[model samples]
Target: METKKHALLSASSSHKWLNHGPIALLEAMVPEEESSEAAEQGTAAHAMAEHFLKLKLNQASVLEDSIYHDEDMERYCQDYANFVVEHKESLGENTLLFIEQRLDFSPYVPEGFGTGDAVLISDKILHLIDFKYGRYYVNPENNTQLLLYALGALNLVDSIYDIEEVRMTIYQPRIGNVSTWTMDTGPILEWANGELKVKAMQAYKGEGNLEYGDWLGMTKIKAISKDRAKHHLELRKYQLREAHLLNDEEMAEVLSHVDDLVRWGKDVKEFAQKQAVENDKHYPGFKLVEGRSSRRYVNVKSVEQRAAEQGIQDIYQHSLLPLTKLESKLGKEKFHDIFGDLITKPLGEPTLVSESDGRPEIVKHDVNADFK
Candidate 1:
């Protein structure tokens, strides 16, 4: 008898698939290697930091042309350094601010990631501050770049220090305002080990492929819209029936079709609106545009491979490796829900997902495995 190879099953149905529509479309439109190249060229902060750290001087220059002109940004950096130094005593001796420092997380990726204008590191507290020179309104509480730096720092210092709280700040110097979030290392680590690990596996397996009719493509969109329409119709009918419980049999029969009636009404309205737009010569036909946000899913193996290709040798030296068997046994839906909630919460809200609000009491460390 020949032995059959059993395929590994994912704990969460949502986990085995990518959810963000824009990323899915981009992945479909561009090849993986090409997308990676675009990502590398677009962001030179990592590269610049790596170069600056090699210098033996106490100061270095980092430039972002989009944020501000070179001279203006340099001036802003000087002002920020002075501000931190003026308030140095309040920030505490163990806390470091307005200093150019590189954190070594793993051997493959070194002190390449840079902290912005300031960092606060007390015995058990680590904070990252970014200075924005632009006039446009920005909510830094949920800023991804700040969070990435926090991740790098957490990986470096968590094991060495009894870190109690980690904070990230976005300082809009032009607006004279700041947004900040305090994070707990324990829950973040748990999320990394659980939900992030599953996402990583999916990315590594190249499961992002979706045909037109696949659930992740056009087919899923139509199916979901139809399902939502059906659900709304059913709910409306149930409410109407309950309201007219004493109606005659004929009236009840009419009421029974209320859901269908409402659905038809909505469909007619949509059809008319679309027709009007089509008839207008100046009007552009409806276009499905991808959103402007980026969705980051974990791909530990790919990340490891990329690191190795870049001559990174000490991946798991400082950081913990994926606890495969242990992670596999945990429920997938639970992990997705936990991470999803963290990602979807709006900025300034009293949730782990939004860290911009000045209030500090809302931070909680509960871990759930249930998918919602």
Candidate 2:
């Protein structure tokens, strides 16, 4: 049994094989004591199964609510298990073949692999399908995991089937979508060899450290340069004062330079703030609206309302301002010109309502009324 640390430290190429096997291989890498504790508490998969059973029996509605514990994982496991149980017949035939059948491909490839999911062989073609439970978008066709399974199947059946093309499909039931991609073994193998060669070189150079060395080096350089510039500015100010002693022209020149510097600094600060707002609009988080309480689930509708209230005119009702329109109107420079004053103002507490307030007071102003 490989230790968890050792398993993780192994090459990324090995992940293809390890990930294809039972989840238990990775599970065993965890400490026995920890695994025992998890088993005693009821594994997340068990909880998910219980949840699904309840939903099926009671016809309960599952809400898109926040979860602090392992609810998400449990739900995913339950869904997959439910799918398997519900579609047993369609899946049973392929599942049996997957479990029992072994193909020989020594003629074309020296090594082969096995897959856990359903496999279909038809008309001199082989297809591999794997399901993912997560909500994030994953392109099924180009996925390396699916590709690895295809490669293994290709090796086993190529001799008997005369396989010309391999088709890999990733079925994401959570999102109700399937992505399929085809791969030609020859070109793929060549690309794989090239990537492996680069990995070997990186390993040899001791450049495989996971720590972000490039970012750290850049951060250090930036800090030192900023400190040097600050010191230089202070020294320059002192020298300017000394040189301006009894010299009116030099004093005027120094004052003008200082004014320009102050103006430039303000302009840069405004530009940066506007750029931040534009960037924030593109972030996925902006599409997620937080509930009044931290424990509550996020609501997309609330996010849309909040975004609209922020003066973001969504012409297409897409909840987000289109990038092209944003660039034309709310780009960094124009953003500050339009919203700088509003951005700088403090959001004061809301005024309290009293019984005497009755109907809300309305203030109306008109040039004709004033003139009359």
Candidate 3:
């Protein structure tokens, strides 16, 4: 028997491959991307949360500190801890807690696995909590990623514990959104056995309706492939064919389709550029261009010494006001009373924006009308 080294269908990326099977095969071939700074911070926050929970669970005397501590992260972790405390009574006496626990759902999906940030197994209910440091709102209900994690958790403790129901919670404390979804083990398992299984098998085989969807993972992979390029070429041909004046309704219809095509084109181009930079590959008639650089003082002391020798004591000093800090020092009302008269609205450069954008639309006015 050949043992699989990696999970073909990871729970975190279930949203993508499930919707479009070919993305799974494509991602399996491509090199993994480097984590962004925000992702790194989120990892650190998770570590801090786990450490804090461990101390709390053990009833330790002193508090352990984290070097990667941030004010927002600390506040978020505290919120998660508080939630656990609130539900402690319902959790029962034989409550078992786990942090960053690896969960396997191999029976449901082929080599499917995920890590739960916090798992609490009790008599009849299992509570799975996930901490999201991202700014986007994450609803626990109908969230494929969290549901997959729930399945993984069930696989781990369903046999050992009398878990009839599961509670899935998403804590996005930065946004002050705590969403919870509770369901019986029957429905969850049913989903796993049904849609999840079909998709996983189809994705694993790399054969199915492989089309782009709203899922970011699917979009990102498709954006860097020849499939997207072919679509782009077809779109351009159609665009030229329909480049004519139209009625208001026709214009709206055209824009509805054109907007999506334009966005996809932009995203695909950007992805290709990033891939080129990473792999040291070049497109014909185009080469990698170095980003603009700025000079910085390596030795501040040496610069200061040189300035002092030149009889300039305040050479390194500049008079600049940090208005926001001053506003914080003074109350908002008081700050406004003092500086409100000086405030002015300047005309900004015009740009197109989607209707969904919350910013007030720029309304043009005729200066000639005032003269008239």
Return the lDDT, model 3, position 98: 74
Per-candidate TM-score against the hidden true structure: 0.37, 0.33, 0.77
Query: Regarding TM-score, does 2 or 3 come out ahead?
Result: 3
What is the C-alpha lDDT profile of model 3 across 128-198, one tens digit per residue? 88888878778888888888888888778766876788899888887888888999988988888998888
Residue-level lDDT tens digits of model 2 in 145-183: 555556557666656666566667665654766667877
TM-score of 2: 0.33
User: How many backbone clashes does every candidate have?
Assistant: 6, 1, 0
lDDT value, candidate 1, whole model: 0.47
Question: Judged by lDDT against the true structure, how good is candidate 2?
Answer: 0.46
Candidate 1's C-alpha runs over 4 A off are 1-75, 86-88, 97-117, 134-136, 142-144, 203-372
Please tell me which predicted candidate would have the highest TM-score against the true structure.
Answer: 3
